[model samples]
Target: MRIKQISVSGLFGIFDHVIPLNMDERITIIHGPNGFGKTAILRILNSFFNSQYSELRAIPFKHFCLGFDDNTSIEIIKNTDNSEEAEKNNIVFKFYQPYSEPVYFYLKPRKIRSDRGFPMMFLDYGIEERHTPIIRSLDIRTEETLFSEEAVEHFNNLSFPNLKSQEEPNWLEQLQSNIHIRLIESQRLLNFVPNRSSRRSAETPSILSTVSAYSDELAKLMQDKFKEYGTISQSLDRTFPVRVVKQQPSTDLTDEQLRHQLNELEATRSRLIEVGLLDKDEDAEFQIQPQDIDESTKNALSVYVQDVEKKLSVFAEIASKIDLLRKIINNKFAYSYKEINFSKEKGFVVTTSYGSSLSNSKTLLPTDLSSGEQHELVLLYELLFKVQPNSLVLIDEPELSLHVGWQVQFLKDLQDITQLADLNILMATHSPDIIQDRWDLTVELKGPHK
Candidate 1:
C-alpha cells in the first residue's frame, strides 16, 4: 500500500513535525551529507512498525536508567489511500503511542540494577535515580494511535494485537499473517523504490496465501488419505489367515513355529521323493535340515521371502508417487527473481541475467558472475522482476558499486519498477544523479534537527 504522509513526534533527535506528502510523487529521495538524520529516518520507519514503545525509548534512555536522569519517547503518523478508498471518499492510517493503550506490541528493556556492596539484581521495569518505578507514560491506545478498524485490526493481529480474550483464535498465528496494508502516503520515495522482498511487508497476501494455503490443504489431504489407507490395510491384515509380518522390536518368532514349518516342508519333499516327483537326487541333498534351523524354519523362510518382496514393491511404488507429487507442486510455484549460470569445469566462467529465459533455464546467484554483472543482475531483479505495487522500500545507498553512466538508466528502471509494483521508495544517497528527478520528496537531513 502507498503511504500518503508520515509525521514523527518526540522521537529521538526529531522534533515534533508533520511531513506532508504529494500523491503525484512516488519516489522520495533523502539527500544530504553524512551525519544528517538519514539513517535515523530508516530507523524510524522500522520502529513505526516493528519496535515496541519501551524498546524504542531504551537506547536513548540507557544513561538515564543508569542514574543520569533522562527520558525519551516516539510517536508516528502514517496516512494511506487507494483507488477503493478514493471511490469511497475515505482515508485510512495508523499512529503509535508508548504505553497504556492497546499497542500491537510491547517490549520492555532488561534493566540491571547494581547497588554498592549489594548483590546484583534486575529491575522489572525502568527505575528512577532514587530507584522508584518510572512507569512508562506512553499511551499506545487512543491518544497515540488511530487507524481504520479493519486496517488496524489486521495490523494488530500481525503485530502486538491483543490476547485479552482467550476465546478468539489469534488470527495472526492462525494464518501466519504478518503484513499491514496502507495506501500511498506520499509520492516522495516512489522513484527510489526498488523491487525487492525487503521493501515488502508481511501483509503481502499473494506471497503467503499461495504457498501456505496450499501447504495447509496438502497436509489435511495427506492426513485423510493416510487414515483411509491405514483403515483398509488394517482390515486386510485382520482378514488374512497366513499373513506374514516383518520382525518387530517387541515381537519375536517362536522356534516351535519354525520347527513345525520346517517339518512340513521336509514332509512335502519326502512325499515327493517317494512319489518320484523330484527331477534330481541332488535336490534331496538340499532338503530342509531342522537341526540347523533356529527360530525360522524352511516354511517361515519361504513366507518371509514372499512378504519382503511384496513390501519392497509397495514401498518403491509409494516412493515414486511421492517424488512425482512433490515435483508437480514445486513446478507450480517455484518462482525465482533472477537466474545465473556458471560453468565449474571451464575455469569459473559465469553468465547473469534477469527473467526465466525462453528456454526456461534455472536462475543463478549473482556472485557467480563478475562484479558489474552481479550488480546488474541485482538491478534486474529490483527493477523488472520483484517490486510490488503500493509497498514501501527504504534504501541506505543506491549508488554503491555501479558505474556513473548507469546511474540515470538505473534510476529510470527503478522508477519504472515502482510504477509496475505501485511502490513507494525512500532512498538515502550521496549521489546527485539519483536526486535530479525526485526533488520534491528529497528531505535534507539537517543534522540534530537544528
Candidate 2:
C-alpha cells in the first residue's frame, strides 16, 4: 500500500505535523537545509519495515501512525527494555482495516545478536557476493523434511496458528517471507561501496565491510596490467573461457535489448551459483506447487496470484546485476565498462569500450576509478540491484561529491531504476542541479518537518 501521508507527533523533534506523501510520482525529492530532520523521516520509515524502533524508544509518544492511501494504517505499540519481561519488547504491529477492526499479531523478537539465527540476508553491492543472513533459527520444512507427519504439524502450528485445516494457505507467512528489500540510502551507501574497503572505511563507521576485486590479491595484477593497457582484458582473461555481453545501455532500450539484459543476468546467476560463490542455490527450483484447494477458492485466488506473478516476472535471480550492467553502460565515465565477463579463476570482470567495441575496449580495476566515479557506481549499483517492487527507498544528499553533470543526470537515472522495478524514492538533497525542473514533486522541509 502506498503511504498517502505521514502523521507524526512526539517522535524525535517532529512535532505535530502531517506531511503528505507523493503517491502519484515515482520519485519524491525533499530539499531543505541541514538539520531539517530529513534523515529522521527516513529513519522512522525504515524502522517500521524493520522489527525494532530503538530510536523511537527515546521519545515517549502516545501515538504515531503511518496512514496509507487505502485508509489503513499501522500503529506502533512500543515496549521498552525496562519492562519486567525481557522478551516482552515484542512487535505489536497493529494493522487497521478501513471500517473494520484492527488485526493484531505478535512476532517475538529473538534474543542475542542479529546474526545468530538464519533469517533474511542483506545484499552487498561492491562487485562481490555477500550473504549476511539475519540470525534467527526458523522452523523451515523442506520437501525432504515434510515426509514426517510430526514435522508437518509443527510447521503448520508455527506458520498458521488459526488455520488447522489442510486446504488453507499460510497467507501471513507468505507475506512475511517475501518481504520487500529494505531502505537503501544512496547517501549512506558509503558503507557498501568499493571505497568502503579502503583504509578510510575502517576508520569510519561502516555498516557493511565492502569487499571488491581490488581488495583481494588481484589488485596487484590489475594494477600491473592496466598501468599501460587500462583495460580488463588481462584481469578477466586468466582462463580459456570468457562470456562477452555486447548490449550497451541506451536512452531507451528495445525489446531485443531487454531480452539481452535478462539473458545476461540469468547467465551470470547460473555461473555464479555454479562456481559455488552464490548462496541462492539452496532455494527451490521452479515447480507447480501442488495445493489442496476447493474450486471456489481456486477461482477466487487465480487472478491475484497471476497479478503477483506478472509483477515478479521483472525480477530475475540477478535483477540487481542487470541494473548494475545498465548503470555501467549508461554512465559514460562509469569505469567505461562496455561488456562484462566471468571466469571461474578470475570471477566477475569488466572490459571498457568507452562507446567502442569490446575488442578495442580498455580495462581498469574498481580501485583505478576516482572517488566520485566510485560513488556514482556504488550508489546506482546498490539502488537498482537491491531495490524490490513497491519498495520505498530513502536517499539523503544524492549530490554528495558528485559532478554538476552527474547531479543533473541523477534524476532521470533514478526514474529509470524506479520504472524498471516499480518502486518509490524519497530523496533529500540540497543541490539545485539534482532538482533541475522537477519542482512539482519537491517537499520543502523547514526544520521540525514544518
Candidate 3:
C-alpha cells in the first residue's frame, strides 16, 4: 500500500510536478526553490489521507494523484471555475484499479452556522494577526467573514463529526485505512493541548514539556516491562520444581553447554539492567563451576537457565529501542558536554559534565537543553516511539534549528532510524547539508519552462 508516485497538476495554477519515491532507499528528499509547492504537496498528501478535507479545498491545485505499489491509484480533481453556490461539490475523488471500474466520490464542504459567531476556543486563545502568515502560506479559505484564518486552520486539523459524511463508501474507507501518514511540520516545538479543566479550552506548551512527558511515558513503560518480568519469574519459579523433576536428562547435555547457557542468561540480565528494564542483582557475581554440577544438578540447572531466558525475553523489544535512543542521543550530546542515561523512576536523566568533580556535575531539566538539542530529541522520539511500523512520515523541514555538523549527520541518523522503525520518510528540506551527496534520492520540483 506504499505510495510509489505522486503527481500534481496546476499547483498554485503554475507548475505541474511528478515525484517518484525512492523505494530502494525508503528515504526521499524533496528539494526545490521557494514557492515551488514542496511543502504544499506534503500537506495535501497528509490532509487527504488524514481526512482533513479543508486543506484540500484551501490549496489551489487542479488535480492531485497518488499511485501505489499495488498498481492502484487515487486522483483528486477540483473545479474552481464554478460559482460560489456550486463550489461545495467541486472536489471529486477517483480511485482506479487494474480491472475494476474507477470509483468516484464527491466531497461536499461543511456548512458553518453564521449565527454561532466563532468557536470559543479560538477567542480564548486570542487569534492574533501573527497567524496571518501561516494562513496565507497554507492558503486557507473560508466564506464566513467572522471566522479567523487561525480558526479555520484549527478547525481543519481537528476531527469533527459534521465535517465528514456519514455515508462514506467502503473502498474509499479501506483505502484511507490502509495508508498511515504522519506530518511533522517545521514548527515542531510548540504543542497545542487541551486544558484538563475544560475540553473546549486549550493551551500551547513548548517542546520542553513534550520531552518531559515522553520521558515519563518511557519510564512507565519500563516499569510495566519490569512488572511483566516479575510476573513471569513468579510463574516460572512456581512450576520449576515440577518441571525439573519431570525432566529426563539427555546424553548430549554436557556441563560445558549448561555453563555456556547460564553465561548467556547472565549477559542478557546485565543488558536488561543496562537498559533500565531490570535492577542490579546483589548476587549477580555468583557463577556455577563445572565441578559443582553433577548429573542430578545438571537437570535442575538446565531448567533454571530456560526459565531465566524466558523471563528476560520480555525486555527484548523495549531494550533495543532504549539502547539505540541512548546511543544516538549520547553521540550527539557528547559534543555539548552532556550525557543521557535511563532510570526506571525518571524517563531521561540528562546530566552535564561542566564541573571539575562528579559531585559538582549538574542535572538539567528537559527544558534546559538548547532548541537544536530538543528538536533532535523530539524528532527521534516521535520516529522511534510514536509511529507504527511501515508508516510514511512526512517531515516539512528537518534541518530547522540544527547546526551544520548535525545537519550533515542527519541523513545517517535517519537511515539508522528507518531500519529500526521500519518506516518510509518523505522530507522537504532547503539545506544541502541534510542531503549531502545523496542527490540521487531527491526529487526536484521545477516551475513552468520559459
Best by TM-score: 3
Give the C-alpha lDDT of model 1: 0.38
By summed lDDT, the worst window of 10 consecutive residues in model 3 runs over: 131-140
lDDT top scorer: 3
Ten-residue segment with the worst summed lDDT in candidate 1?
61-70
* Residue-by-residue lDDT tens digits, candidate 2, 37-65: 67666666664444233434334443467
Q: Higher lDDT: candidate 1 or 3?
A: 3
lDDT value for candidate 3? 0.80
Query: Using TM-score as the measure, what is the rank order of every candidate, best first?
Result: 3, 2, 1
- Look at candidate 1 and tell me the lDDT of residue 43: 49
Off by over 4 Å in 3: 113-166, 195-208, 282-292
Writing each residue's lDDT as its tens digit, candidate 1 over 38-150 gives 55555445433332222233222111100000111222222123465342322112122235342231222212222222221111122245543222111223222211232
Candidate 2 differs from the real structure by a C-alpha RMSD in angstroms, to one decimal, of 17.6
Candidate 2 vs. true structure, TM-score:
0.51
In candidate 2, which residue pairs get closer than 3 Å at backbone N, Cα or C atoms, i.e. clash?
Answer: 117-135, 117-136, 118-136, 230-363, 231-362, 231-363, 232-363, 320-385
